[model samples]
Target: MKFVNSLLGLSLLLAASSQAHALSRNAGQTNQSAQQESPDSPRPILLNYTLLKTIDLATLSQNLASFGIKARNGVSIYKVSYATESLDDTSLNASGIIIIPDTKAAVFPWVSIQHGTIIAKAEAPSVAPFEGLAEASQGFVAVAADYIGYGDSAALPHPYIIAKGYQKPLVDLLRAARELANQKDFDLGPLFLKGYSEGGYATLALQKALETDYSTEFSIVASAPSAGPYNVELTGVLNVEKPVVNPVNLPFVVLAYNYWLADGQLALNDIFLPAVATVEDALSGAYNSDQVFAILPSTASGLFQSAFVADFTSDQPTLPTSRDLRALLRTQTLLDGWIPKAPTRFYHCIDDNEIPVAVTEQAVATFKAAGAPSISSVLIPSPTTGQPYLHGNCPAIFSPLQWFGEILSGKAAQ
Candidate 1:
């Protein structure tokens, strides 16, 4: 069987936009705490922000024109560093990018974009131009987070697919964005969330966190979680066991879980074949996805030990490592509780090779069964190929930003 390189052209396929309005640097505008604070209360999440750079209208337009996107407004990109708790309640400084429109407004709607799986640190929003640029140019205060493994937290292993762990950076980034807006005198209107691939999972996770814990502090207008593995216990864990296109992700997730959840108890030799077990060099921020892909087996399961494979495939795993993995994957599953209250849409290509469409279909069914208020799924087919839309190719065809724009303009059902 031939292995498909599903990670091809990912950087170009996932290109994004961002920027904020130019306001006077007022002394009072800096981040500050309330007059009175409970002794036990934590400090503010938004520590401080630095204006990284600004892109004028012409520059933004010229850059976007290559992708057939128009830039209506210039953008200012700011690198936001904030404090957030890690998996073990350790205080960590994480970073992300916030792109605000150049034009002044009393208020702007916030669109937080959770990026998909990124290998290199350079792919992080703070370092490179990815998805939120077009959004900022469209007049939305766009933000994208550099997950724990990237940006300020680059030294640490990313908590890949860990629902609770990944949501912190995203949640804190939104808090930072809101605080930044507040300091500028203007305010943010409705809140919107959008993400694809791993981001799609993060989107649902973030939404669940906000609706469950931060309801008073924030309200979601809508969410578009595209091509995410919400059913981690069933679909997510099983997908990698097969002949997957992007095999490198298997090690990525395993290494992350080992560090964050398993206390690094699972050794490289136990999880992977000796030939490919040494992945630290490739997974480090220095190497790109293509480089990582080159080192791993074409199929994820090919990298695993036969004993591990047998245990994973069995109905009841005898191996302690396999059992530990199942337990960890179960914790990340999102199909069970907390039906989304706000309008929600799950997008996917019916024939996605990386993350199967069944993942989204099953999630929608579960949400409906749980009496979700507003839930729908958009299954898009490849316009060019007329066949399967590989995971890397789906974003270019379906438009989350356009769907979000429709909702903001009151042109789409909310």
Candidate 2:
């Protein structure tokens, strides 16, 4: 925890001298690609930026040493506000952290990391530094989007598992990063996407949109979307049928859908029991996940109305409200529609309880059935427990950063 604090503390130092030295506009040589910007394709994505802090090589290496990672270069952390859109296509300002590696390499690859479930707005990447710092030190220009419900859009409710909701902000952020690179006179190399849990779902959403809608504008080198509930219709909603380890997840999703999908007209009384229907107050970006968890019930039946639970769990749900909820869940599915063109790897712990390993297996099987080329899955066991790697253990045990190292080193094919 001290190391994490050291990272946050280092990010708060706002020395102007270090800031100037870190991103000296005239320091590095410009790339030919930077000079050949398309005339009509202006850099209008970036709205504004702030130099949060710069981490020196020694300090960066010390901070990452505990994770068995050695820093190769220093990095400049910037909190960037960019032009993006909400789920309804309304133009808005979204924010994210861009960690630029302080290397003389003229060009750097873009690695966008979508973070896992963070209930509080303060935990957003621009607020608290995480993997982006380590990724920057490893020579990648890492980007972490704060997403809609956090950062600049903190006033809005987070659109939890909605695919299009995650897609828009991330795509715009990448475009904004490109604009930043062009302005900084540096060239961006291949784009790599990685994320875990909710971020994993967001990564897949971004990848699908890039491949399906924006292929001509952006090309992905590879993507690792690990431990996500890709088939949300089945894997996500079925949490009600099982004893949940994480209680806040279901309520959060319900409230998100009510606000985004049903336009907040689904009526809380129709979804949750009277005792838990006021859950929106706890999930309003005010409490952390643990605090929210303590306030909610451990089982879906305990939280949701018994009749609503029965309708949801039934094979042929009769109620119109139940059917409407099912339709919304179906729309959130990332599994069936299209096959991925990039080298995609699905990583998960074999013993994960929060999100079952079967989610990945189901997705892989569906993709294989659809003739998805260059798709694979890796299920790992816990080094410490040796069994039940669990959802929290998956990221540490089968890390995407280590996987990216292999892909970059050519040890793992991309």
Q: Best candidate per lDDT, number?
A: 2
lDDT of 2 at 287: 77
Instruction: Please give the RMSD of candidate 2 to the true structure.
Output: 5.1
- Tens-digit per-residue lDDT, 290-399, candidate 1: 78778767765567777887787688887988878878888888887788998999999876877888889999999999999999989887666454467876753237
Residue 398 miss distance in model 2 (angstroms): 6.6
Off by over 4 Å in 1: 1-42, 275-277, 384-388, 396-398
State model 2's lDDT.
0.78
Backbone clashes in each candidate structure, one number apiece? 15, 0
Clashes of 2: 0
lDDT of 2 by residue, 275-318 (tens): 54358777888877767777877776677777877888789878
